[model samples]
Target: MLGVKKIGWSVLLSLFVLVACSANEKEQSVSQNDGGLQVTFTTPKKVEAGKKTEYTVHVSRNGNPVADAEVIVHLEMADMDHGLNGFRGKMTESGVYKGQAVLPMGGDWIAYVKVKRGSEKVTKRFEFKAEGGMMSPEELEKSGLHENGSLKNPDF
Candidate 1:
């Protein structure tokens, strides 16, 4: 009886871990509707800091794609300020816009997407987390730290 109970508990714990990991691997997508316009944003399941990640946005009005619109995405750290990190998205297909942006650090982030067409405009926000990765060249320079992870100003 004791052996059976241990086996049952082990199986349950294994299942729980599997479920959690699978959930984390699923893509993160968000949809919003504002002023008769619907926007869907899709991102990868895992985003690494300091690496360029492609972001996709789909915009539609009354079930029809909004093709001739300007799309801009601004990435900001939710817990801290890292300056303005903005990029313009180009239309890859009807109503689909794609762009790339490098996350500055590993932490919670918010992406503010703005779409403009003629006199109409729409904006949406999506929040996500980025995993830690190697620092980019620009980030290294701004931090005044050497690539070897040493401080340039040793006196300080």
Candidate 2:
């Protein structure tokens, strides 16, 4: 009767609204590169302990960049007194994240990269070497200097 028609219209309208809202709520953060895949890291791979370092990640396929992707970074050092307790980063840009981590000491460390785009996820691990002896240019030259402040073995 009339009540049945009204109920059908109401149900259809509710479904439409739900679909529209869900479409707007989709959270996607992954970009496609060229034929291959690549992630970007803004921070330097070499850093001194206790110093802050930042990094970022991006997805690409076929040498083209893909936009809007979620990337996460994790750092771990085995020699430090703290074992994986201090590590965190934020995704500041699309398919990019900034990270601040302190190099525990001079040794080998493991850095992890995790990226997600829709249902696809990529994870990679990299090894980093940290050491002491932060020297100036003058000091470096001095260390490599000869007795006469010239080349030790001149070849001319």
For each candidate, the alpha-carbon lDDT, in order, equals 0.72, 0.47
Specify the highest-lDDT model's number: 1
What is candidate 1's lDDT per residue for 27-114, written digit by digit as tens? 7788899767798888888776666689899999888999979888877767555556756888999999998766655656788999
Candidate 1 least-lDDT 10 residues = 147-156
For model 1 the local lDDT of residue 4 reads 70
Q: Which candidate is the best by TM-score?
A: 1
Residue 49 lDDT, candidate 1, scale 0-100: 64
Q: Give one digit per residue, the lDDT tens place, for model 2 in 51-80.
A: 445555555655555566566666665433
Which window of ten consecutive residues has the lowest lDDT sum in model 2? 147-156
* Superposition error at 57 for model 1 (Å): 0.7
Give the Cα error of residue 36 in candidate 2, in Å: 6.6
TM-score of 2: 0.49
